[model samples]
Target chain A: MAQQVIIKVDNLVKKFGNFTANDNLTFEVFKGEIFGFLGANGAGKTTALRILCGLSSPTSGQVEVAGFDVYKQTNKIKMNIGYMSQKFSLYEDLTVRENIRFFAGIYGLSRKIIRERTDELLNKLNIEELGDKLISSLPLGWKQKLSFSIAIFHRPQIVFLDEPTGGVDPITRRQFWDMIYDASNDGITVFVTTHYMDEAEYCNRVSIMVDGRIEALDTPETLKKTYNAKNMNEVFLMLARK
Target chain B: MDNPAISIENIIKSYDKVVALDDISFEVDKGELFGLIGPDGAGKTSLFRILTTLLIQDSGNAIVEGFNVVKDYKKLRTIIGYMPGRFSLYPDLTVEENLRFFATIFNTTIEDNYDLIKTIYRQIEPFKKRLAGNLSGGMKQKLALSCALIHKPEVLFLDEPTTGVDAVSRKEFWEMLKELQKKDITILVSTPYMDEASMCDRVALIQNGRILEVETPEEIVKLYPHSLWAVISSDMYKLESDLQSFEKSVSVYRFGDSIHLSVKDDDIYGSDIKEYLESKNQNKIKVEKIDANIEDCFMALMNNNDL
Candidate 1:
């Protein structure tokens, strides 16, 4: 079976005045695949991600997300994708249930479906009892998990997570990856950016951006073999140092 | 035989009804690189503040360089270098100005302690004219460490130094820490990354305001009580869910591209898991015995503590 290309970019160029943030980048993310967008600080990864998420317009070239053109059909593209940022954007004063309802409502989910899914999500994450608890009282891991469940509550075709597990413990990080894998298994493509190189291994394919360009793009196995590196950390250093 | 570089006994801290540190106790030997390993809100910052005399503990005692954290704080302040988690340097000041300002505050000249920070300072020296805010993440870290060491303190306390830095920069920063360790400076560093735990001479795994275990990285990994197996399949996500249903599977969690399964010693075999997943029509099934790391030990401890 041929996997469909869910995200397509060809010579995508994004510039901020004299500087090129994403310089003629080209890549394809297949359906249901965990595609890792990796880069160091000031490497233009966030710019490229924002452009893909329909939050920013590119300077030139072709870009498509979820079968919608980024330039003209941004609204349609936004309707079919979910985005979770590095910062925990949940309301601190609101209860967990209230936060879920607020986000779900904004996403245009039906009230009945929202109620059903909210219950299901709470049960799945083993936090059903904490639904009435204020978000500020939750631990960092619980808040992260809750935020992730809320992001995908509408069941978007693609999800964008930027450093979703930063400052989390290893065990919690593993669990978060499990959540990502579960989403991938459900036929939803995952587009994630992270600073942890070890996480690059979890992706089916990864594209490393260096100095506003895609320096390497391949499966973790092939990249490690091609670079003759023991792990993704070494692979990242090899390219980033250049 | 000499007193440890830093010592804490039954230190407790709380904010309102939330207990941040409960009966925490630890010691750092002279010239040792120690790590406080845990997730966020694990009381690392609270503990660092107490040791540096920036915050008072609710109960118990902490001593740095033979001075009580509470009573002798005035004297203790001069003997320790502290870099907080947040970038607290003067953003408006140039890199050199910040370094010089910090040196003057400690009543010393950058030239007098130039040898102590020569290695780290050289990295950021080129950016001396740049404002601290305009420098890159890695460069800012270098500048901050330079300022912290300007006074040549007897010990260093770094709270999550590499929290938001890039992986390449993180590796470089750890290397610089190794260089600093060579100077025989007692260092206590806290980070959430388990991989960094192995770099320290010893680490204390803390969670929910309590220390789970304190030992060398190698020894902590050796504490993983059960044998571990790496399991992979064509559909790893489904495989993980299916494996969790198996009664014999003690604990299963994702590790990189594969799932690590912990089983009773000499009880569960690789062949048994392969047959089970194969019977369920999971393709490309591979299960093999593997060695555990500090992360595995931490998970085991967390699980046990939760139960």
Candidate 2:
């Protein structure tokens, strides 16, 4: 059961000069679980994600991903985890197939595996016909879906998605979560941050951060019951009010 | 003088042979809060742009408040307020400065009509000195609303005004719109959030540049056309897959923690669906007949439009 705790944090603190972005945050993500990190805009959700993904440093406390210290094992963590950001973090000038080739190349996938997986992902996403189209031409939803697929192309143990469906419609959002479900089914842990309350209900467990502190964390059902609310939005409102 | 607020007869718009609006025709009732409800690229923006005299239609005619959109573009501009999907406030200017600039552009001032925006402006009054770019998303949204209302135009056009905004802010924004509606300013707003459909006086469900149905929110929800159910069960993936496999599943759409299922016929009983899930080893299966909401009506209209 020791392997179940794929990620653990204790009193994790991150500060940028005088501002403490993340304060004494503690949480644990289980194996094969979809974890949701939620908060308002500028609520320090992004700050905590940056620390976990090794994009920045924490001023104090401890963080361990896949049982490795984030400070000492940053490179190993990068190799073992995938991170999809809020922005479309791909080359807009490149073609669909070329974008996949570039990222898979960096992860050092074998040529045969890259070619096979790239084709499979494109087909599954129903964007095979637009494989030659520039990333700039595709709609917002398609760009987000492709960015997510590219993030996890290397088969990382833990994949973090930061507001993966920010401006997309509900139907496109359903499609994006379907891919996320597919990933988690393959034993990959999904850690996603979103401001959308309905999307928050999609997670196996959720933690709400407010004012640089984690205010609530539990399964969606439990959180709803505990807060005496009907949905995640009400629950967030309840906690934010406090 | 033409008396209608806006008029369009079989207006078609295309970009390089790609049809965006196809023979779409609609009219804005005087002093009516009209809503164009659909997802992204559903021609909501295109329609608003056309009605506001920004883009000319290809084959038909459209007029705003009796001014031909194609012929009297300048006359239409002074009478219609437009708030785009993205915030268009000058980022370099402060909240008050931005409001002042827009008012001046329309040949008015904050002192001229401060009462029109008093409700919304009070919320942002403390931040009047802060640049528009430095404000929060919700604050920027309020500022935009105030600037648009500063001129007190006859018609207001908002394209997905609530997108990217928090729930509280969205609720607040709609309240402000409703308050403004009492003053008889015809409001035409477009949004992708199906839940927001109920807030409007009358809504036109548009998809693929075509109007599916037009009705009041209550009337639309009342005419849901079929019975719906909200099913909650364990092993959600298995339950979802099983529901999809079931022949009775019209459309198993997810709504929060429950999967909302619709049936082809209105008379189908809910107990049968509950029992079917029970036989599939799905625990905690609870399927009860529920009332159809605006979202349900919108989906039904969309599905019907497909046919």
Which regions of candidate 1 are displaced past 4 Å?
A110-113, B245-247, B267-285, B305-307
DockQ, all models: 0.70, 0.47
Candidate 2 Cα errors over 4 Å, as ranges: A1-3, A16-18, A67-74, A89-93, A126-128, A136-141, B1-4, B305-307
Instruction: Considering the two chains of model 1, state its CAPRI-style docking category.
Output: medium
Model 2 chain A scores worst on lDDT over the 10 consecutive residues at A163-172
Candidates in order, TM-scores: namely: 0.94, 0.92
lDDT of 1 by residue, B126-167 (tens): 879999999977888889899999999999999999997788
Q: TM-score of each model's B chain?
A: 0.97, 0.93
Q: Candidate 2 residues B80-120, lDDT tens each?
A: 89998888999999998999999999999999889899988
Best by DockQ: 1
Instruction: Pick the lDDT winner.
Output: 1
